[model samples]
Structure formats: structure tokens, C-alpha cells
Target: MTIRFDGQVALVTGAGAGLGRAYALDLAARGAKVVVNDLGGDPHGQGENRAAAQKVVDEIKAAGGEGVPNFDSVSSYDGGFNMVKTAIDTYGRLDVVICNAGILRDVAFHNMSEEDWDKVFAVHLKGSFTVLRAAWPVFRQQSYGRVMLTTSSSGIWGQFGQANYGAAKTGMLGLMNVLKQEGVKYNTMVNTVAPVAGTRLTASVMPQEMVDKLKPEFVSPAVVYMVSNECSTSGYVIEAGAGNFSRASMVKGPGAQPGMAANLDAEWVQANWDRICSLEGAVPMWRAGQTLAAFQAANAKQA
Candidate 1:
């Protein structure tokens, strides 16, 4: 079956180039009225221009797709509100939002400055919050919405010299997880995408050949599906790039139960270290309170 967004509106931040551009183009081609938002800032989040975003809008227009340029920084609350307002005012409704705006401040943990760390959060983490919060009420009233947050491998599994960026990226998952539960009844799905595309953000870190292969085009397909009505799952982290797609998750180990032991201490944990850390029967919890069952089951089995 063909996936189409006909009559729906979408907002893609950082749509001036790379992954965001790919997403906006793809969505527009598939019949969505797209809002191509770009701060047009440098990799370090300095400076801005309206040309980059307008160029993408021009491309969409040339291709006979509907799109409008939105030059706004996602780092502030007002910017976020205006971005969504632009969609609603022009298209009358917004069904999707791809939070792809971010900045890079790569430095070792010891050398990373407070300004660098805070700025990274301002764009990647808080930016997601700002935009999503602006659209939350609309989704609730309409009872339908799709939200895609851009995460990274550095945040999921960690990487060298990206302490600040990694921290901000990983923090998005926490927000996604909570929103998934809250949005369930309203049919608002929240998901994360950890892309390994060769955007300007990765140009410096990756080899030429590898970067050439991992174009943003390859990653945009999975992202489009994530925001489309075709997707049924939520609270999932999908890793995509170079025509490969996979699901990533957080799991809990079935640890040894400390049942009825009133005097448990660090020594007991030390004694059962192997059993506590074993992944043999580890499983992913579907929700926040589900982990308590592991203790109950272990105690019951022990009894």
C-alpha cells in the first residue's frame, strides 16, 4: 500500500539541509503541506539566514509540492509556538512534527564548558520540548498526532568527545517515553530516530566514503513511516541509515530477589553480583511500573 499524507500538515525543523531537508521533501512529495523550518545556524549554532529554508521551499514549489519556509530558532519557547502557529494558520491543522534542529559542541567531558553543555541542551533537548509542548494541546483536542524526535547513537550507547551532545540527545528519549503513555488515549504517537546520516554534523567525524554512502535520503524513509498514520507502535527508538533499519531499546535484568530479608545491605548485593547483572533473562519493560513485577515474580519463585 502506498503511504500518503494528503490533506495533512507537517513541520520539519532544520529543514534547510541534510536529514531535515530530506524529510521535508519526502513529506511534501507524498501530499503533505510542509513547514520547512530552519534557523540556518552554523554547526556551532551561531548566526542565521532565511535563504536556506526558502531554498527548500522553492524546491518543493518547483516540484509541485506545497511548502512554506519558517526561519525560527527552536531553542526558545516563542520560536516553537510560532512554528506550529505557522502551520495551523496556513494549513489549518498540523498532524506531524519532526524535531530535527540541533547543534554540535564536541569536547571531552573535562574540557567541555558550561556554555557548550547548556547550548547543546537548548537546541536538542529543550528545543524538542518547546515545539512538542506547543503542539500537545492541538493533538489532544484533535485526538490524533505523530511526533518524531531526533536522537543519536552517541546518546543511546555513548561516544567519545560528545559528552554534551550525547547528554542532550539521550534526554529526548526520557521525554518521548513519558509522552507515549500520556498520548496513548488521544492517538498521539511519540517516537525517536537515531540516524547515522552524513549531514554537515557528521561531515567532520566520518570518512569520505562512509559519509558518501550514508546519505540523508536513506534515513528519511524510516522517519516518514514513523510520522505516518501507517505506524502503530510508539515509545520506540529506531536506528536508521544507509538502507538499514533496526529497533533499539532499554531492558531490565531479572535480578536475584532480596525477599523478606530485613537486613539486606551492600554486602548482599556484592555476594549476588553475577545474578544481579545477568542478562540471560533480561527483558524490556513496557511501562514505568512494570519492573516491580520482576521483584514479585522472583520472590514468589524463591518462596
Candidate 2:
């Protein structure tokens, strides 16, 4: 079946160029009224160029799709509110939000400055909060919404000189985990995308040929699907890029239950370290309470 947005409205932050621009254009092309938002900042989040967002909006219009340009920084609360307002004012409703706005400050942890950490968190982590906090109410009241947050491989795994960026990206998972539960009752589905596309943020690190192959557009299809009405699952972490897609998740090992003993001590933990850390019979944990349940079930089986 064809996935179409039809009368729905979507807001894509950092839509000036790269992934955000690709998302906005794709959503608009599929019949969504898109709000193209870009701070117009450089890769490091400096300076501004309003033309960046307007150009994408122009493309949407040129292709007979509806779109409006927004020049707000996602780091600001007012900027987030205004972006949502733009969609409601122009399209009368908002059905999707793709929090793709991000900035990077790569430096070794020891050499990282407070500003480096703060700026990256402000754009990638807090920026997501600002927009979602603004749009959350609308989603609940309407009882329908699809939210897509951007994560990264650097964040999920380790990366050199990207402590700040990686930490902020990993934080997206926690946010989605909580929002998924809260929004479930309202039919508001939230998911994260860890994309490996070559964008402005990565252009400096990769060769031109590799960048050409890892086009941002290749990652958009999975993202658009996750935020569409057809997607039934929520709180998932999907990795996509270069025509590959996969799910990433948190799993727990079959842990040692030495702590259940009355004389549980550090010595016991030390002796059972290998068992505690073993991945044998590991299971995916969908919620916090599952840990306790898994432990209890293991104990019952042993008894």
C-alpha cells in the first residue's frame, strides 16, 4: 500500500540542507503540508543564512507540494513554539514532527570546553525537548501524532572526539523511551533514527566519493515510514543509511542472583562477575520493570 500524508502537516527542523531538507521534501511530496525550519547555522552552529530554509520551501512549492519556511533556532523555546505555530497557522493542524536539527562540537573529552558540551546538547538534546514539549500538547489533545527523533552511531556506540555529541545522541533513546509510554495512550507514536548518511556534519571527515554514495535521501524512506500512520510500533531505534535498515535495542543478560541471598556482598559479586556479565540467554528489555520480572522468573526456574 502507498503511504501518503494527504491532509497531514509535518515540521522538519534543520531543513535548510542535508537530512532535514530531504525529510521535508519527501514529506511534502507525499502530500503533507511541510514546515521547513532551519536555523541556517553552519555545521558547528555558527552564523545564519535565511535563504537556506527558503530555498527548500521553494523546491517544495516548485514541485507542487505545500511548504513554508521557518528561520528559528531549535535551541530556543520560543523558536520551537513558533515552528509548531507556523504549521498550525498555515495548515491548521500538525500530525508529524521530525527533530532533525543538530550541531556538532568534536573534541577529545579532556580538551572539551564547557561551551562545546553545552552547545551540542542545546541543539541536539534540548532542541528536541523544546520542539516536543511544544508539540506534545497538540498531539495529546488531537489524540494522534507521529514523532521521529534523530540519533547517531557515534552516540549508540563510541566515537573519538565526540563525547559531547555522542552523549547527547544517546540521550535521545531515554527521551523516546519515556515519551513512548506517555504518548501510547494518546496514539502518539515516537521513535528514533540513527542515520549513517553523509551530511554537512560529516563532509569534513569523509571522502567525496563515499559522501556521494551515502546520500541523505537514502535514509529518508525509513524515517518517513516510522512517522507515518501505518507504523504500529513505537519506542524503536532504527538505523538506516546507504539502503540498509536495522533495529537497535537494549538487551539484558541472564544475570546472577547472588544479591538475593541474605549475606550478599561485594565478594559474591566479584566471584559471580562472569555470570553477571554473561550475554547467554540475554533478552530484550522493553521496560524498566522487566528486569525485576526476569530476575524473579530466573529464580523460580532455579527453584
* Residue-pair clashes per candidate: 0, 0
Backbone clash pairs in model 1 (N, Cα, C under 3 Å; residues 3+ apart or in different chains), count: 0
lDDT of each: 0.93, 0.92
Per-residue CA lDDT of candidate 1, range 1-303, in tens? Answer: 399999999999999998999999999999999999999989999999999899999999999999988998999999999999999999999999999998899998999999999999999999998899999999999999999999999999999999999989999899999999999999999999999888788989898888888899999999999999999899999999988999998888877777875568899889899998998877777687777776678778778
Candidate 2 per-residue lDDT over residues 1-303, each given as its tens digit: 399999999999999999999999899999999999998988999998999999999999999999999999999999999999999999899999999998888999999999999999999999999999999999999999999999999878869999999999999999999999899899999999999888878898999888888999999999999999999899999999999999988888877674354478789778889998999888766678877787788777767
* TM-score between candidate 1 and the true structure: 0.96
10 residues in a row with least lDDT, candidate 2: 254-263
Question: Cα miss at 154, model 2 (Å)?
Answer: 0.8
